[model samples]
Target: MLIAAASTIVLAVVVWATVVNTEGWAAVQRFFLDPAIALEYLSKIWDGFLFNLQVLAISVVTVGAVALVIATLRTLRGPVFFPVRIAAAAYTDLFRGLPFVIVLYIVGYGIPTITNTRFPPIVLGVLAITLTYSAYVAEVIRAGIEAVHPSQRLAARALGLGYVQTLGRIVLPQAVRKIAPPLMNDFLSMQKDVGLVSILGAVDAVRAAQNAASQSYNFTPYIVAGVLFILLAIPTIRLTDWYTARLRDREQMGSIV
Candidate 1:
């Protein structure tokens, strides 16, 4: 009640101040509430949004597959496999340490130059997002693998399961389940970070907004693009919250049973 009362009082004061301040009212609406351009932006930005969705879908799959390989490599044992482990560690460290934009530049522009190849900008966008995000996802999967009880591995071996079988049958599954929430978090981050492909000149939502704004010299297009992203993101956000809460409840009760 106290918190609600305080928030209401603050909101009332802010609204009153805005209503009385003619300059502030005009400025806010000029940037954000331009009805004349809203429909124009809505039509153009949706085309770009579809491209964003395409890249996101492809990047998610690429990251998932590549991350599992890297995570498995990191968990390898035996002196003969030492080089493989070091290589995997180096990959994760190198990509994770670099800013996503730098990685995007390297893969998006550098690869094309080196290979004398051309891919549509959306392909480059997915590749860049996949490369950067795979490293992080590998770490998440590695943590999940580690969180599986040591005893499970021991039990699997006692039943004559090989190391590969033990890990595949026993550890990775539990790790994935344990790390689902964190993985979802990275997925959400990827949804926004996909926007960085604007640097590559892909006409995704942000790029569409930029193109629209350039013609008219108003920021309404950017606002529309942002609103589109938020609208798309909200359902996933709510699902994540509900899933996280259910996980907490299960943990507190010590299992679904």
Candidate 2:
């Protein structure tokens, strides 16, 4: 079933590429082959690309920090943990339930309307992606934390280590290794989600391409944008696969030893 689905997707992509090449090749040539025209288009795209990178970097870091704190609180099992757990659950549900565009709108527009303070488009874009993806990262962190053996925690407690001490010293380190692959995947998703911020009038790569296409009445800029995204995403996907394989090999070696 998976093979069939994959084949279908490949076939569709090939057909789409064929159509684009046939119909859009003139625009592609005019936009890309003409040095002056290409440079002009590329300059606009460069600005957008920089903003996209900024948004991705800021969002990933913020999300990672927020996820770590929330995941830690969620993993703590006790009466004192109840409120944190509830808050975490609510956060995960609320963000995950909302679409990315809606989140961007709220952060970009809604907050400013209420507070009468303007937020930078890039800042709002980063906040939207961070808030949305943190829930997913929180789950990844929670799973990683749980993967640490109960015996390890008990042993830490027996050795006069407090909960925080044991978690920081032992549990989180182990959990990080287990969670690295998924966390990388989430970052890749965030990279793509940067395009969603374009809807909020943030001039991201996609938006720049859109403006170019609209002004030129040509599809080549959009195609260029797609290619750029693919170029960026391919490396991350390969790295994620490499890291996952490395982790698996280490696990196997330890088991054999």
**Poorly placed runs, candidate 1 (over 4 Å):** 1-22, 254-257
Residues 1-257, candidate 1: write the lDDT tens digits: 99999999999898888684667878778876798887877888899998999999999999999999999999887999999999999999998999999988998889999999998998899889888999999999999998888999999999999999999899987887789889989988998898888888788899999999998788999999888888878888888888899888888895455
- Judge candidate 2 against the unseen true structure and give its global Cα lDDT, from 0 to 1: 0.85
lDDT per residue for candidate 2 within 89-175, as digits (tens), equals 899888989988888888989988999998888888888898899999999999999999999999999999998999999899999
The local distance difference test score of each candidate is: 0.89, 0.85
Top-scoring candidate (TM-score): 1
Write down the TM-score of every candidate: 0.91, 0.84
| Number of clashes found in candidate 1 | 0
Q: Which candidate is the best by lDDT?
A: 1
How many clashes (backbone N, Cα, C below 3 Å) per candidate? 0, 0
Model 1 lowest lDDT segment of ten: 18-27
